[model samples]
Target chain A: MTKNPIVNGKLVCVALNDSEQFNAMQAEFAEAPYKGAPTQPVLYFKPHNTWSTDGAVVEWAEGADSMVVGASLAVVFGKECCRVSQAEALDYVEGYTLVHDFSLVEQNYYRPDIKGKCLDTTAPIGAEVVSIADPQALTVITSVNGTVVNETPVSQLVRGVAELISTISYIMTLQPGDVIAVGFPGQRAPVAKGDNVSSVIDGVTKLNNVLGN
Target chain B: MKHARVLFNGSTLDVTVEDSFSETGQLKSKADGQLINEADVTWLSPIAEPGTIFALGLNYADHAAELAFAPPTEPLVFLKGANTLTGHKENSYRPDNIEFQHYECELVAVIGKEGKNISREDAMDYISGYTVCNDFAIRDYLENYYRPNLRVKSRDSLCPIGPWLIDKDDVGDISDLKLTTHVNGELTQEGTTADIIFDLPFLVEYLSKIMTLKPGDMIATGTPKGLKDMQPGDTVVCEIEKVGALVTNIVSEQEFYGDKY
Candidate 1:
């Protein structure tokens, strides 16, 4: 399948706050919104230049050996959707796909460092989108060199598809082709160069990529 | 006069010069000088392709004080996506289950010429024109992950920019203009560009050093204090003296999301 070329499309990413796992990490913030269980979804972005598709190869800069891989599910919008209710959110979704949110793991999680996240070919999404009514029932698996490194149930996502669509639409409109990554439930360890990285959402779509220079 | 892109005949977007504003606005075709009825068309962000939106945080002393942060000696730069860019008169969404979703009326500097290492004096020349914008913030989406998180700042249509672009030559002395934001006819925020810690030319010069400023790239300098939350159906009028007024409609998540189910 021919991969979708990202022509300056918006790639929105969310943060996972699995209560038992994320609580302690979130405790460091004493601020109003950050202190409590996130009243709103924590979000970030991977710009168009960072977008790639299956069979793509991502190169690491000099002195940079390994990068973090966030294997997750992406909700692709069928049409323009805005301020949609959770009950009707899924109606606007076209289908489900796979995404590898590549980043250079950094100790500072306080703020998003673009250099660490937004790199050319860093985000490789599945070329094909599969229709799925219930996304949370699926499992997302990541492998490096054919060895399973991380795997989690989509149900573990802090905010499900409907809620994520409803919450995000409150600010802007999501058009056809715009993708919102539901997020990975756990930590994404680092994978070094010359490794084959693959992310698969059981029975939905699988993505393969090679880490290079 | 200012340039604007309006939805002509429902689907076609054509450039027009906003001639004047009244209950029923007036516009002239930029290509053929034909008159257009403002009500007959929809508004779009004056600059269609705003490449790499570079925003500033705490560039104003009053805003820094309001947020309980120390005034930074240097500009805090962050990137926002183009999806957040919506035209004037458009509605911005405020999700349910959160407080502190506020409006930040800002002066937008549109880059006209592409340049790197732009000098402070020549920086002003690189700017094409000025426009008004409401940098709506969903503080509920605020996280330590980023000062202006994508959820908080870059949500679709969160940044309502432009009724039209006021040519740089039309607006003299960019540093002394007055910025006022009215919510439902009540003036909630009022400040002068003079209060800005970093001036426009300095910002362009500062940013151009880090990255190239291309034509149509917008620098949303920063916002002032007097921040407050808005509700659904509320009308936000953001006006920059000498520049035009940019009106935005606010809708609740439920209302905007529609009851399709």
Candidate 2:
């Protein structure tokens, strides 16, 4: 059995990196609280406690009726990267994997969704990391109980894989083994207790987890 | 007992701080009992490998009112990455062209035991020790999305924690401890831990119910009112009544990054 690729690193996630999601929320971004679309990447951290390997059982947070599951391509860094250019960003990547990013349903993005997103075992990573020639051309498919519920193309990302590493590395250094989940599509699949959730990065890897409690 | 991690003689060592020390004498290595000079060694955050860093925003009623907002009914919490942490006597950069950057003196509770669904009554049992941190914020990067966004709160070297970790038993009665911040030898911010809207036990219980709390996880229990703008060349000392004082220097981006900026 292959080891979980993100066991030793911190998981940093990008929000609204999907072009479809960014465009869908464009009008709301101009309204009262936001006043404008994000000029830079929206980032959040999935701490170690939230990390789990494939085939794990994830428990629901208290009173949580359902969860929004997002399928994403995980970029594993191989080098200490800081302020690298987009052209050289991919050179620092170790490989790619799949991740099922789970969160409770939230209405607004005004505050950091800690309670909704940082639940234990909510982020299940693929068993192994595999090299891919072009991460931008890949597609992610999420399923519930063996049935496909949502599909998104990596081409729809507002900032491609290389650009995300470049932009984020300029703000904070990315050490070896660090994982970045290059955002998720606007549409996501909802999973309930006792359901099997699986996310796959087309031909690369698959992550499976069972929702419980 | 107070514990610390420091870089002495080109290697990291776990050391314990003695109750009595001269101005120059500081730490004693646990391995060899060798006395080390404070100025000769580089200080590091007490916890060598921290798990998750949870920070609170607007957890103080006075601070919420200072920012012209009502106190949150629920805890306004956020997660910070490890890159933001710097050790005592370190330099936290003041990004160029930013109008407002401030220091937040906060009490940090370090979790010692792994727990899920931890109750408030048992929260005290989970804490291993206490430390002080200066949670700095660059107000210019504030955005509505994730209001206290990572850009503003989690910038590299933005959070400076530790002088040492004091065992909880040594620092009794956390309910009304005094928290203060001094900038350039002038006392500028002051408040009591009693002003914190959501106390430590409440935070531990609330967060653990959402996710498991692992050993080395730290919770920065928010700051109070009296925030003042900090500029380059300012030396800020954040001290809690029983906890140790953590000192940090504010330097310009050029000074912090040197030729890289």
Provide the TM-score for each candidate, comma-separated: 0.78, 0.96
Residue-level lDDT for B180 in candidate 2: 91
Please provide, for model 2 over A75-163, each residue's C-alpha lDDT reduced to its tens digit, 9 standing for 90 to 100: 99888887789999999999999877888986678899988889877888888988998999999988899999978888888989999
Best-matching candidate per lDDT: 2
CAPRI tier of model 1: acceptable
Chain B TM-score, all predictions listed = 0.94, 0.98
In Å, residue B72's CA in model 2 sits off its true spot by 1.1
A1-213: candidate 1 lDDT, tens digit per residue: 123553235678876544434665656555544454455676777655567888988756335666788787888888888768899999998888888887877555455555577565778888887899788798888898999888888777677778988988765578888898888755776888878998888756899998887
Index of the highest-TM-score prediction: 2
Candidate 2 chain B least-lDDT 10 residues: B18-27
Least accurate 10 contiguous residues by lDDT in model 2 chain A: A1-10
lDDT of 2 by residue, B65-181 (tens): 999999999999988878888899999989889899999999999999989889999999999999998889888899998879888888789999998989999998899999999
Question: How well does candidate 2 match the true structure in TM-score terms?
Answer: 0.96
* Per-residue lDDT of candidate 1, residues B9-72 (tens digit): 8664556564445644667777777777878888998887776676778777998999999898
